[model samples]
Structure formats: C-alpha cells, structure tokens
Target: MNKLIDGFLRFKKNVFPQKRALFRDLAGAQSPTALFITCADSRVVPDLITQSQPGDLFICRTVGNQIPPHGSAPEGGVASSIEYAVHALGVQHVIVCGHSDCGAMNAVLHPERLKDLPSTNAWLKNAAAARSVVLENYVGLVDDVLLHLLAEENIVAQIENLKTHPAVAARLARGELQLHGWFYHIHSGDITTYDAQAGRFAPLDHGSATATPPRRIYHFSAGDAA
Candidate 1:
C-alpha cells in the first residue's frame, strides 16, 4: 500500500505534469482505438507493454483472460465491457493477450495442488475450456512445456470467444473491427501473435505482421444479424 501511494505521488508530481496536456484532453473525452483484454495479473501492464499513451487502449481484465461465450449469461461485466468498447466507443481492434507464467493457467493444470484456495479454484473454472483444449491437443509435454502451450492456446481460444459477443460479431462481419490473439513471454520480453494461416503463434517481428485482413462489407440480412 505504501509503495502504491508513493507511486501515485511520484506520478502526480512528475509523470502527470509531464503529460498534463494529454491527460487534460483525455479527461474530457476519450476515443481509444483498441480494446485490450488480458489477465488480471499485476505483471501484465497493457499500457506499458504496448507503449500506449492515455486514452489509447480501453482495457478489460479477467482471471485467465477468459471471455465467456455470448449468451452464456444474461449480464456480465466482461460482456458489457466488450459491447461498450465495440458498439459505443467504436474501437477498431480487440486484442486478447495471454502471458507466460499465468497463475490461472498454472492452477488449471494442477488443480489438486491448490485445493486449499476454494475461491481460486472457483475462479479458475472460467479457464476450463483452455484446460481442455490443451489437454486434448498437447499430449506428452512435461509440466513446464504443457503450461507454456496452455498459456498460448488460451489466448487463441479467448479470441474466438470474444467474437461470440453480438456487438463484436456484428462489427467484425461488417469489416468495421478486427480481433487479435497475442502471447507475451515474460522471461524473454517478446510478443508473439497468432497466425491464423500458419495455425501457430509466431514472434511479432516488424516484417511479419499477423493482423487479420479486413473483410468485405455486407448488408445485414435476417440471418446475419446477431
């Protein structure tokens, strides 16, 4: 708590003053370009990672960076946040980022080991799909390797889940929005993007962009409306 208070004091005295005009402009209105979804992990700072300024990326965080399928519940904070970012804020891109050394994924891989933390056990239920996907697809890797694969697969899985939201689906269909899956390696300080064509996560080199291509716009048909 003391560390956080001191950090804020330093921010007010130095960082805030240095970016006062940018903060002032953002105070009135914000038009962020991307919706960045990731884990609720203290190590993963979206703004710092992406080098984004204030009002650049609207963020949504969950225990495992999970996005429950649309209509799974009538009302959810994650769903509402996604809808607002897409339909209201008109964010152009949605990024689902998962990181290495994810505690949520680690717990899912070894549930019995953490039987003491009932609340943690319950929260990690959200990552059940991620666990199943990894178990089915990655058969023989040892614990560490399996955990890494699960972390990467979770990012891809959640991006697909993100598209299940009505607003996100509608916008994507109209070529008005794009979705991305990314994995951040904490140890290496490297970012990798899921290549739909290659069906793998590859390093995010400047020459190898993995962003989805814009789709052709189409008029909303009866079946097309979400």
Candidate 2:
C-alpha cells in the first residue's frame, strides 16, 4: 500500500492545496448533479473519465455494474444508494456505464468458469437478462465481438433495472430525471452512448448531449428477468 500512501501524500501536498477552496465549499454540503453507476473495475475511473471534480457526481460501483431490481430484496446496498442519490441528493441524471474487457461480464457470459466463485456467480444473476439477450439472439458469434455485445447489452439491462426503483420512477414520470447507458472503450478511451432514436449506441461526441429514453425497451424473454 506504499503506492497508495505516496499518491495520497502527493495529493495532500500538491493537489489539495490548489483545490482547498473547492473542498472548503464541499465541506458543508454537496449537491452533485449526477449519479454515476459503474463497474468496480480499477481501469474504469468515473471521475477521470468524465472530468468531474469532487462533489460533482454521486458514484455507485458494483461488480459487473449490476443493479438488483427493486423489491428483489427488502434491503440492499445498491438500492439504498440509488434511492438516496435520486430522492435525497436530487441528481438529475443517472448513468450506467460498462466497459470493454470486463472480468465480470466475462463471468456472466461463462457461468461455468464461475463455479468456484459462488458469491460472484450469485451477484451476476442481475446480469442474466443481458446474457440471455446475447446468447439467444447473437448466436454463432464468439470472442471479442461477443464480449463487446454483452457489455453493451448489460448496460442496457441495468438501466432497465434502474427504472424499477421508486425514486427513479417518480422522477422519470415527472420529467425530472434522465437515464443514460454508456460503453467505455478502454483501449481507445472512446465512449459511446445509447441513442434511442437511432436504436444503437453512438459515439458520445464532445459538446453533445444525448438523453436516453427512460426505457429503450429491449426484448428480454420473460425467463431472463428471473
């Protein structure tokens, strides 16, 4: 952990001093504008990717970026965070981001490989609909292409799952909130966002705003939702 301590030391001596005023203002209260839900992958740094500063985004990181459906359990960590970010923090936007070369997605695509990882396998059940979408429809494709498709589909799946939450649903119905699906191409640092009108994920070009539909309505079979 020397590397982390050294990084913190550098931040304390250099970065924190420069942003002292910003931190002071944030010390009292925070009014973040967005709730960023992403994978617990070290490579996908949300703040760095969005160029957001402290107090700008409320973040929730989960394995595979999976969000359990509302009421699936009485109490859940992800659910609580989602409720607070939407109902309490009043975040206007909710972004579910997935990335290429995701280990969690890999395990979702191949449950056989997760036999030894019972907890991980159980956690990824939230991503089952995405896996079903790819396996049932994108038959015959394999390797990187299949992996890429699954990642995108997983983002879409999770966004749908987001709608089931009461806080998110209420805001959406009143036109007070927006949901976005993002795919981060790690190697190129290129980001693609879901475009409801075009029915595909297109490059999230700089200086452009893409507001995803509350639900893009992917055709996941009934069994998949289980």
Candidate 3:
C-alpha cells in the first residue's frame, strides 16, 4: 500500500501540476472516446497499453470479462454501465479484451476447480458459450493451447453478449457504435484483434478497424494462426 500512496503523492505533486489545465477541464465532466472492457487482471493496464489520458477511455473490468447476454439478468451492474456509456457518454467504440491464461477461462475448462467457488461457477455460465464453441470446433485439443483458445473465444462471446444490451443494439442499428474483440498475450505483450472478414485474431493495425457487429463468428486453430 505504501507504494500506491507514494505514487499518488508523486502524481499530486508532479504529474497533476503538469496536466493541471486538462484536469481542470475534466473536473466537471468527462467525454471518453471508447468503452474498454477487459478482465480484472492487475497486469493489463488499459491506459498504459493504449497510451490514453484520464478521460480517454471508460473501462469495465470483470472476472472473466464476462458480459451476460441481454435479458439473462435484470438490470445488472454490467448492463447498467454499458447503458451509461452508450446513452449518456456516447462512446463510439466498445472493446472486449481477454488476456492469456485467464483464471476464469481456466475454471471453465476445468470445472472441478469451481466446486468450492459456486458463485463464480454460476457467474461464468454467462461465458459458457465460449467453452462449448471451443469443444465443438477444436477437437482433441487440451491443456494450455485449449485454454488460450478459450480466452480468445471468451472475448468474442462477451462482445456478442454486449451487443444484446438494448442500448448497444439501438446504437448499432443506427451505425453509431463499433464493437471489438481483443486478445492480449500477456507473456509477449502483444494485442491481436478479431478480423470479421478474416475470422481470426491478428495483429491489430491502425490501417484497419475491428469488425462492427460481425455476422460470422471468428474461429482459430492452433496451427492455422501464423
């Protein structure tokens, strides 16, 4: 905790003064560009990765980055945030990012581990589609590779769930929003975005945009990826 306190002090004394004007402007309100949703992994810092300022992105972090499909839960906290970001903040984009070796994905692949974590077990059912998708398509795969694919697929599944929200559906219908699926490779510090046309997670490039409400689901095999 001392480290965090010291960092705050440094920010107040040095960094705060440097960006005082920007802070003053943001004091009353904030208009972020994107709604970035990712796992609650301490290592994945959205600001650090995207080089964003304080008001650049509105972030939502969940255990598995799970987003329950609309109507599955009534006015859930996650859905409330999605509504706020879309209706109130008018964010242009929503990115569902999942990382390598995700604990939630691990539990999904290994159900026995969840015997003691009943609440988590139920919560992860929101992402149950991911496990099924992998099982149906990627036969004979197991261990780390299977888990890796599960993480990637979970991001895709959650993004689909995100679209089910009334706010997101309305905005998408009006062409006012874009949704993204991202896989962040923790060990390598690399980000691969799902390309709806290509139907695979490839290195994200500034030249291209993530598919908006993809008609087809993106899938990958261990050998098929370059």
Q: Between which residue pairs do clashes occur in model 2?
A: none
The CA lDDT of each predicted structure is 0.86, 0.90, 0.87
* Tens digits of per-residue lDDT for model 3, 1-226: 9999999999999999999999999999999999999889898889998899999999998889999888885338788889999999999999999999899899999889999999889899987889999978999876888999999888888877887899988888777888988888889989999887777899987855586753433457998897
Q: Residues 86-189, candidate 1, lDDT per residue (tens digit)?
A: 99999998989999999989988999967899867776766777789889988988999999988887887777778788998888888889788889988888
Cα RMSD for predicted model 3: 9.0
Please, what are the lDDT tens digits per residue for candidate 2 over residues 115-221? Answer: 99998888999988999999999888877888999999999888889999999988887778988889999999999998756768989986434445443335579
**Clash number for each model:** 0, 0, 0
Poorest stretch of ten by lDDT in candidate 1: 205-214
Query: CA shift at 135, candidate 1, in angstroms?
Result: 1.4
Prediction 3 TM-score vs. true: 0.91
| Candidate 3: residue 142 lDDT (0-100) | 62
Off by over 4 Å in 3: 213-226
Ranking by lDDT: 2, 3, 1
Q: For residue 58, give model 2's deviation from the true position in Å.
A: 0.4
User: Each prediction's Cα RMSD?
Assistant: 3.3, 7.4, 9.0
Q: Which stretches of candidate 1 lie over 4 Å from their true place?
A: 207-212, 219-226
